[model samples]
Structures are given as structure tokens and as C-alpha cells.
Target: MSKLGQIGAKLHRGEVSYDFIGHRKLWFGISIALVVISLGGLFARGLALGIEFKGGVEYEAKVKVTDSTVQDFGDAVKATNAKDLGDPVVTTINDEKVRVQTKPLAQADIGTVRAAIAKEAGIPAEQVTSQQIGASWGQQIADKAILALIVFLVLVFGVIWVYFREAKASMAAIIALVHDVTITVGVYALIGFDVTPATVIGVLTILGYSLYDTVVVFDKVRENTRGITGSNRYTYSDATNLAVNQTVVRSINTTVTALLPVGAILVVGTVVLGTGPLKDLSLALFVGIAVGAYSSIFIAPSLLAVFKEREPGMQALNKRVTAKKAQLAAAAAAPVGVATVGAPAGAAARSDVQDTPRKADRATGAAPAPSSRPMKAAAAGRPQPTRKPRSKRGK
Candidate 1:
């Protein structure tokens, strides 16, 4: 184990026993549950689209209104007869102009809204460059964004598969990325945050970041697995575990560093500057960074182990290694007095018990000891066997 791997091992308790991707299954199941919950939230509460998609009236006015900030502009729009101003977007694009984007108003309602904004900022309607977008553009923008999302997924999975050369590995990594995205998006939907063009951009950025983290760990696994294709020294799961442990700390550090700026945006943009694209984009990044970090570590690599080991040959490899170890152990524990049961060259072997030998006397040649005891007397000393039972009658 590397130093980092050692630290992670100390930090996390390893699996007590092998279960053939059982731990990975836990990760997969949880990931699926999160996706389902997120999709449900998406269905329950619709996305909050900005003026760019909602086809609302937008105003870009460089009015030098004293003591009137973007919030003042929004308040001015809402306070006057255009009270139904539908969340005016105010941005300090530069020193002189505060670009305001807002929802579209009716032809009759347009004049009143303009007059109210002008009065609040104390600028004439001529100073405001206002444009109206029809609601039809929302559907188009949504369609295009969906198309782009699909295209992105295909490209991402393709790149991973080509780079890894293992379909299961690529698939596992992609699923983890999707899991992170779903979690982030679900939170956004539940929180009712605005889904603007900027939000879409942020989502793409996060996807790239998540993939980078996964690729880093995957690269480590690939390096470890080199030249270890056949032997059991480094199983696929072993390489993956080491890889995850090695990069886990790095992933955590990267996420924390990226989150700092996003945290600032959430604070400064929303709390200090009020509602804007920065706020929406910040919200998305904040959610994505956390989920991306999680999926890269616990979700991705674990899934990789599970999927890579799922093949029939790989399964057989694990069983063979286990059986070999067991056989060696049993051989070592045999009793000390017991000998292995075998014969050489197909010759029958005998036990260690010996038989008494019969030999001729050296001095008197053969039969020299035949008269030591009379043969007849010696034979007579031997007990006779019992006679068989006689018939009931002598017939």
C-alpha cells in the first residue's frame, strides 16, 4: 500500500470477507434510489426557468439612478402599478448600466411596467432597451438542452470505454457520474432554484470535473494491473481498491478547493447581491461538488470492482485461488506418524510390520533342528480340533 493508501485503510474499515461484489451492490442500490428520488422531485416540482427561457420582457438600461441598486430596481418595478413584475433580474454589467431581465408583460401591461421602472430609477422609458420574448422559445431552449445532454452522455461513455478497454469499467464510471448529476439536480428541483442557461453550463462543468476524478483513480488501477493479466498477485478488485484508497484524499481536497469559490458566490451573490445568474450557478456547483466527490470514491471504484469481477472466467479465478490455498493447508496439517498413501512405478507396497524368518542352521545344514523335539511328540502336544456334531440316528 502507498502512504496515502495506508492512511485510507486506517480510516476506513475494509470488508471482513469476500462476497463477490456484495459491497458494490450496496453502492449501486443506493445510487439507484437517489436517482429515483431525484426524478420524482423533478416530476413533482417543475424547474424554475429564467427570463431567457420563460420568454419574459428584458430591460438593459444604463440609468445613473442615485441610491438605486439592482434590488432598488426590482423593488421599484414591484412597488409601482407593475406590481406583478415576476422577479426582475438586475445585474451590474458595468458601472453605468444595470442590465435587467424579466418575464414578458402583456401589451396593455407593458406601458404601466415601464413607467413604474422609470419612476423608481428616475429615468425616462427611452433610456431602457427592453425586448420581449414569446413563451414558444422556452420549449425550444428545453429541447436543445435535452439534446445536448444526451449527446454529452454518449460522448462521455464512449471516451471512458475507449480509454479503459473494459465495458464494465466504463459503464460503472458513467453510472456514478449520472448518480451525482441526479442528486444535484434533484436538490435543485426540491429547493425550487432557477434553472437558467448558466445553470446548464455549471452542470456541464461539474460533469467534466467528476469524470476527471474518476479517470485519475482509474488510471492508477490500470497502472497497477499492468503485466498482471494472468496471475493472482493483483486481482482486478485489489487494483481498484488500492487505486481508490490512493486517490481518495486527493478527490476530497479538490472538491473542497472548488467549493470555496462556489460557497462565496452563494453568500455574496445571493445574500449580498440578491437573486442573479451567479446565485443560480453557484447553487448548482455547490451541490454538484459534494456529490461528485462522493461518487468518484465510494460509488465509481466499487462499481468497477463489481462489474469487472462479474465475468464467468473472473469468478472461476477467485474460486481456484481459494481452493489452492485450502489444499495446501490440509497437506500441512497431516498427522506426524501418517505416511502419504502411494506406490512407485505401479509396484504394490507393504506395511512396516515384519514377519518371522525361517532359516537353515549353518553347522548342520538343512533339517538340523528337525530332531530338537520329536516331530510326532510335538505334533501330539498340539490340541486336536473338536469333532463335528453326529447325526440324530446312526442311519
Candidate 2:
């Protein structure tokens, strides 16, 4: 096998493992910090809703774009000062076109704004085009997006609960999902990315992707923890940790594979094309996929372990496992074959005969002889018996 395959095998067999469960506090702390920062960004620098989400008028002008093109066009639109025309958002596309967005305006005001932008671009008024979006339509889209998110979350919860038959796993999966969404959204808000209908679609798509990774880990957890209460070899946390390790490599591979194309799209949309639905969608997907992979490996399994370890059965199992380990340690520390000082000679000799073969059996992993005979120890300094030479008569 290749080196990575060998490592994966070792992880599956519990030969190589990371204590994701044991170090959950650290992970939780980091997640909390990131979430706090995200929340802060959302409150301080709100999302830049696209014209699809908030009703607005858009004007496109074919012009020789320059470093100051966006600023120059934005100034021209503001100069028109048409009724209800709020601040215009100006951006460049392909270094050839300038696009401006503003609050919905009257028909006469729309022409004036379009003419102003055209004049600034040194193009004919006919060359500049305009489109108006209504506030009611935007509101409907927002409501539907919210409704879709709710339905998706409800279905995810129901499916996981039914499949795992464990409320803790379901809850953990949801928390991880929320973590992925929150981080992705927060990144968008912080970066001032436009939240369009395509962005909403991207967000919904990533929820499924995130859930998929979480479910895989949870399935492994369920498999590892089955009938665990009857065994003293591992606690619930240990099993969960093993499950995380077994699936970590797979999650990394899947996330990397998914991100490559999404990353390309994001670069093309933002750097080459200069803003479109593709950019918006790819940004959400890229952030969500990475964060989902992280939450699956760290957040979901660790939280499940925390919840499971709190149960009475798991607590009892942990105690039993701990006690068993202590007993083995004590036994290993005690001197073997040492008789009590007050013991009788016969008793001491019998103990030696019994213990010697048992120790030998343990060391060699071989079964003891079936004969009910005690092994005799050779006396110190006694001459060893030698085998007699075979006669040549048979030849």
C-alpha cells in the first residue's frame, strides 16, 4: 500500500489516532471565537443584499473602464439626484463595462440616471441600458429563501433522528450544520459579498454537503459504539475519537476535491468576470465546504462524545474500563512467583510449579500441557543430562 493508505489503515484499526474527543474543549473554544467574530462582522458590516433581494434599478454602460471608472460613474449617478435614488453601487465588468445599482426610481428618473451614466462614459444615451426590480418581488424571494432554509433544517433533523435513533447524534449534526452556515455567511458579510438568489441556492446546496460529511462520521460512530456498554475495552469517548480518526482522511480528500473547481469559479467570477451569480455561488460553496469538513471532523463527533459520555450507561462503562486498566497495571507491578514469608515450604513449592507454567504460557501464547503433572524445577548447579549417541546398527 502507499504511505497514505497505510496511515488510513492504521487509523481505522486504532493503531494511529487523534484524540478529537479528548481535546474537544480546545476545538470548542476555537469555534466559539470564530463564531463570535463572525457574529460581530454580521452586526457591524451587514450583508450586501443584491438587487434581487432588495428591489433596485441597475444601469449598464459600455465604457473604457479605468481605476477611477467606478468612482466616476457613481458620482455621475449621484449628481442626477433623482427622486428616491439612494446611493449607487458601481462596479466594473471585464475591464470594459460599468454596472451601477440603486434604489428603484421613477421612469423619468431612470432615463435621467441612465443618460448621466452614459454621458460620463462618453457613450450615447442609447448605449446605456437599465432594468428595474420591484420591492415586492424581492420580499417574496426573501421569504421563500427563509422558508426553504427552515424546511431543509426540519427534514435534516427528522432524517438523522430516524436513521441514528439517537437524538444526540442528530443534535450534534445540526450544530455542525449551523456552524458551517454561520461561518460561511459571516465571511460573506465581512467581505461585503452580494447576497443574491444564487447565493441562497449555494447556501442550501452546501447544507446538504455538510450534512453528508457529518452523517458519514456519525454512522461510523454508531457502528463503533454498538453494544459498547457490554465491553470494558473502550469508553464512548474513545470509540467516538476512533470514529473521527477513521473518517478524517476521507473528509479531507472529499473537501479538497470539491473545493478545487469551486475555487476556480470564484476566481474567474471575481477576478476575470468581475461579479456575477457564479462568483456569489462559488464563494458560498467554497467557504461552506471547508467549514463543513472542519465541523464534521471536529465539532460533530466531539459534541456527540460529550453527550454520550454524560449518559449513565457510558459513565458506568468508563468506570469499568478504568478499573480494569488499574487492575492490570497493579498485577504487572507485583513481583511474580514470590512466596509469602510465612508460607509453608510445600505450599510455596506448589505455587512456584503452578505459576511457572502459567507465566510461560502467557509469554509464549501456547496452551498448557493436559497432563495433571507438576513441572519440576532443575536444582541449581546440578549437572544436565545428555542425550545418548544413536547406534549405527540401523544403517
Candidate 3:
């Protein structure tokens, strides 16, 4: 690979990651500011709720229409005398054909709506095509979308729990997904895209992409950790580093390929053509896809590393490894702490737990019985000195 590519791989893998948690205070202000700014965007502007949620009529028609010259569809809807007629949306479906869509219409006005489309396009009422879906259709779609999101979250959580068999991995991925989804929604509100059924569909698509990217990195870590014995070369951190290195480029490539067409639609529909379905759908996808990629690579993987490092067992492992390495060097230099240390090296170093009495120690391997002291005092007190028997002390 090129030097830039190699450098990027290392950067994602924490080859350059500093003690970010140790410096959490440094980022705390930034994090809070971002969240507050995002919330203000959400609260002040509010979402542009689509016709589906607000209850609107949807019309689908195969107009015997060509792009060359046709009367304005908007003017036709205006002539229909339909109550609350929104701007009629238009686009081409295939060769020499077009589709005219509009917001929901009242149930009583369907016939007048029919007559309007016929008159506007200069076609016979029968020859011009149409179907009307009620505004309540939005609720059904919303319910299904909510159900799908919940189900997806549950499955992803369970699968991560099983795959990594590590709580840290699951939490890291879930939190990052939250970041992605929320940021996308926040952007939607800020930019004011109409929240259509297409938006819900876009968000769902983002969920799958986000989860897949997270799992790919996690899987790489798991595979790389076969014998991650606390060596200088191999640790939980190293496995994580390798995982990120392997996946960052792939994630970027996947996100770029998916967004290319969406990007095109965004540019053309908004700027050049001045209209299309890209408004309702592609906007959310564009934002969600970009955020999903970022969170999966940077936020999710970094959080996983941070979380696992905080785990007591993992901390203990690092302590043992460090202690062992130090003790080995000490043994070579002085040879006393080495001889005094136990066979298992770090096992017998229980500074917090008291030793068993001689009789109890000999009777069984378990620790000594408690002195019937109250729990609070015993735990609260400093270690008390105990006298040894005369015979054993001399020996």
C-alpha cells in the first residue's frame, strides 16, 4: 500500500491514540457543546414531518407524458378545487414517461382530484392513470418502522454479547449506533427534510450498515486474539489495533460507493433539476451513512478499547504482566524478591486479603475464619499486626 494509506491504517488503530480517557476532562467541554448545539437544532426548528405522518393523500400515476412539453401539473391540481392541494411533485419513471405525486387529499374530493389530473395533462380522464392512498397510511408505516428499529436493536445487542462474550463490546457498539442515529436525526431537523416513509426506510438501511461495520471490526479483533498472552507484542489493545487497521479502509470504500449515486441525486435534484424523490430519502441516507461510518470506525472501536481497558479483570491482567516483567529484572539484579515471591509469580501477592492462621492454614487451604468483628470496622480498619508463635518465628 501507499505510505498515506499505511499511515491512515495506523492512525485508526490507536498507533497514535493517546490516553484519551486520562484526558477525558479535555474533551468533556467539546462533547457537551456538540450535544447542546445538536439539541438546539432539534428543538428550535423541529422535524419537517412528512405527509405520511401528517396524514396526506398520495397519488401514483403513469402519465402518457413526455418531458418535451406538457402543461404544469401544479396548475392542474390548482384547477381541481381539491381542498389543501400541495405542490404536485413530478419525475420520470422510465423512457418517455413521468410520475406526478401530491400530498394526501380528502376522501370526498377523490373524483374532483381525478378530473384535475386529466384536465392538467390534456389526457382523457380514463387515459390518465391514478391511485389514491389515505393519510392514515403514514401511521401504519411509522408503527412498522418503530417495531423494526426495536427488533433490530435487540438482535444486534444479543449478537454482540454472544460474539464477543464481552459486555464492553456490546455497549460500545450500541452507544455508537445511538450517536449515528441521533446525529442523523438532528441533521434532518436542522436541514428541514420532510420526514417521509422514505426517510424511515433510509434510517433502517443505516442501521444495518452501522451494525455490519461494527461487527466486522469486532470479528477481526476476536480472530486476532487467539494467543494474546500479555506479551509486549500481544495484548487486548494490540488485538483492537489490528482490528481497526484492517477495517477502516473497507468501511470508507463501502460508504463511498453507496453514497456516490445518492450524492449525485442530491446535487442534481436540488441544484440542476430542482426536484426529485432524492429530497425525502437520500438526504437522510447521506447524513446517516456518513455518521454511521465515522462512529463505527472511530467512536465505536475507540470506545470498545476504552471500556475493556477499564474492566477490572483486564486491569488486573496488565498489573500481573507488568509485575512479572519487573520481578524478572529484579531477580537478575538482586535475587531476593525473586526467591521470596511465590511459584505462580503474581498469585500469592494478596496485599488486601489477610493470611490464614497457622492451624487454619495447615488444616485447609482456605483463608482464616473471621474474628467476629462488625463488617464496617473490619473493612474500615488498617491492617493489624499479628504475633507469630515462638517456634515458627525462630525457624
Candidate 4:
């Protein structure tokens, strides 16, 4: 088998595992550091809101081959001879289209800027197209985006809680979801990416995908741990670790398959197509999905384990599992043919409710108690009485 296949098989069979739940402190520390850094970037640097959100006037002009360039356009806009034009944002599209953005402007000012760009690009005045945008529309859009996010989170919380029947699992999944988004937005803020409607859409889309990935891991955990308290073979955390290991390869595969296309779009949009919605959308998706995969594997399960371990029942169960494992280890280390003594049956029963041989049978070498039903003579190993053939004759 291939190396990856072998590793996957080991993981599936619980032969190989990563103790995500056991080393939760380290994982929590890392997540805390990342979240702090992200929040810091968000508040300190802030995001560069796009024209759709900030409400700015934009102008696009087409220019034929001439002795003009972006630098010449910048100089022209700088010397626009119009008051309060402020700083202009300029981008070149396909080396033929020049797009310029500036703060809201009066009609006369717009005309001035258009005329300036046209003259600078050596293009006809009619080739310049100008549009005025209102801040109210942007405000409405921002409100709607926030509302949509809140609703999405609410629905996701309800769904996860209901499906898992465990609030801690749901909480962990939601926290991981938040981690993915916060890091994605923080990267955008740190790099000063324009926060556009497309970016918002990408963020929302990734939330669902992130939740889906986390749910997959959590579902495995639920499956592995069903009726876990019935035996001491494994603790809840051990079951969770096995679940994560079993699904780690699957998560990596899914993330890689999904990311390849987004990475392509990001590269192509930023490199080949220049600045556009594709760049904005793909950048958000790439960051969000990558972080989502990471949190699903490393963060969510660990946090869930931590939360579960805090419960009184789980804590006691874990203690019993630990003690049982220690006992088994000691028994194995003893010399060959050495009988290791264990705690009394009553104590073991009170601790784990596991089946143990009756103390009386062990002491006296007597058979165990019989079942409620009467056994047949042959089955019970008792010889059958010789049938009295004369009984029929006597009757």
C-alpha cells in the first residue's frame, strides 16, 4: 500500500493517533495567540471598505495606444485643478481600461475629473464614463450583510445543537467557525484588502463550508463515543482522538480539492485579470477554508474534549478509565505465571460497572448461580432416570 494509504488504515483502526484532546492546552494557547493577533489587526489596521460600501464616485476611460501611462494619469488627477478631489485610486485593466475612484463629488467636479482623465489618457472626452454613488445605499448594504451573518450564525447554532444533542460540541464548532472568519478578515485588514460585497459573500459562503467540515469531525466523535460509559476500554477523550485521526486524512483531502480551484482563481484574478471581484472573492475563500480545515482538526475537537472533561460524570469516568488502564499495565509487567491481585469485585463494580467473576466462585471453586429458567437434564449434565417400563402395565 502507499504510504498515505497505510497511514490512513492505521488511523482507521486506532493504531496511530494524535492526542488532540490530551494536548489541548497547547492547542488552546496557539488558538488564543492567533485570535489575539487577528483581533489586534482588525482594530488597529481596519479594513479598506470598497466603493460599494463606502459610496465613492468611479470613472472608467478607454484609451487607444498612445504615449500615456498610469503614472501620467496619476499626475493628471493630482493636478486636476479641482478643489477637494482628495486622493484618487487608479487601476489599469487589460492595459487599455483605466479606472479611477475618488470621494463623492459634485456634478461639475465629476466633469472636471472626467475631462482630466480623458486628456491624460489621450482619449476622447466621450470615451470617459462617470458614475455617482450614494452613501445611503452602502449603508443599507452594510446593514443587510450584518443581518445576514447574524441569521446565519443563529441557524447554524440551532442546527448543530439539535443534531449533536450536546451543547459543548455545538459551542466548539461555532467557536472554530468564528476562528476561521476572524482570521480571514484579519488577514484582509492587515493587508488592507478592499472589503467589497463580493468579499462579504465569500465570507458567508465559507461559514457554511467551515461548519460542514467541523460537523463531519464532530459526527465521527459522536459515533465513536456512543454509549462510551458502558465500558472502560476507552475514555471519551480517547474516542475523540480516534475520531479525529480517522477523519484527518479525509479532511485534508477535501480541503486540498476545494482549495486548488480557489487558489487558481486568486492567482489568475490577481495576476492575469488584475483587480476584480474574482480576486476579492477568491482571497476570502482561500483564507477562510484553510483556517476552517485547521480549526476542524486541531481546535474544535480539543475544545470539545476540554469542555466535556469538565463535566462531573465525564471526569469520574475518565478517572476510572485511567485507573483501569494502570491496573492492566501493572498486570502485564508482572513475571510470567504470576497472578496479579486486583481490587475486590464490589469495588470494581462500583467504579466501572464492568462484569467480574463472582468472589464466591473464585474462592470455593463452585459453579455460578443458575439461570431463572430450569435446564433440561441432558443440558444440565444430570443423568436421566431409567424409565420404568412397568409403570404403563401397572396403570
TM-score of each: 0.75, 0.77, 0.67, 0.77
lDDT of 1 by residue, 1-395 (tens): 88755666653444322332346677667778888989999889967778778788877766663434877888767765553567677777656777677676777677766776677667798777777887788778878988887898889888888998877778877887788788888988888878888888888888888889888988887876675547655467766676676667678778889999889988987877776778888988898888888888778888877776777766776776667777888988876445557733322222222111123355435443333322464577787665556874455
Q: Which stretches of candidate 2 lie over 4 Å from their true place?
A: 59-100, 106-108, 116-129, 337-395
Off by over 4 Å in 1: 1-22, 64-68, 81-84, 227-229, 324-395
lDDT of 3 by residue, 153-176 (tens): 888899899978988888988887
Task: Give the lDDT of residue 363 in candidate 3.
Answer: 84
Candidate 3 at residue 17, lDDT?
41
| TM-score (C-alpha, index-matched) for candidate 3 | 0.67
Q: Give Cα distance to truth, residue 391, candidate 1, Å.
A: 81
Q: Which ten residues in a row have the lowest lDDT in candidate 4?
A: 348-357
lDDT winner between candidates 2 and 4: 2
- Candidate 4 stretches with Cα past 4 Å from truth are 61-99, 119-127, 337-395
Residue-level error in angstroms, candidate 2, position 232:
1.1
lDDT measured at residue 21 in model 3 versus the true structure, 0 to 100: 33
CA shift at 214, candidate 1, in angstroms?
0.8
Can you give the lDDT of residue 115 in candidate 1?
A: 70
lDDT, candidate 4, 186-222, per-residue tens: 9998888788899999999899888888999999999
Q: CA lDDT of each candidate?
A: 0.74, 0.88, 0.69, 0.83
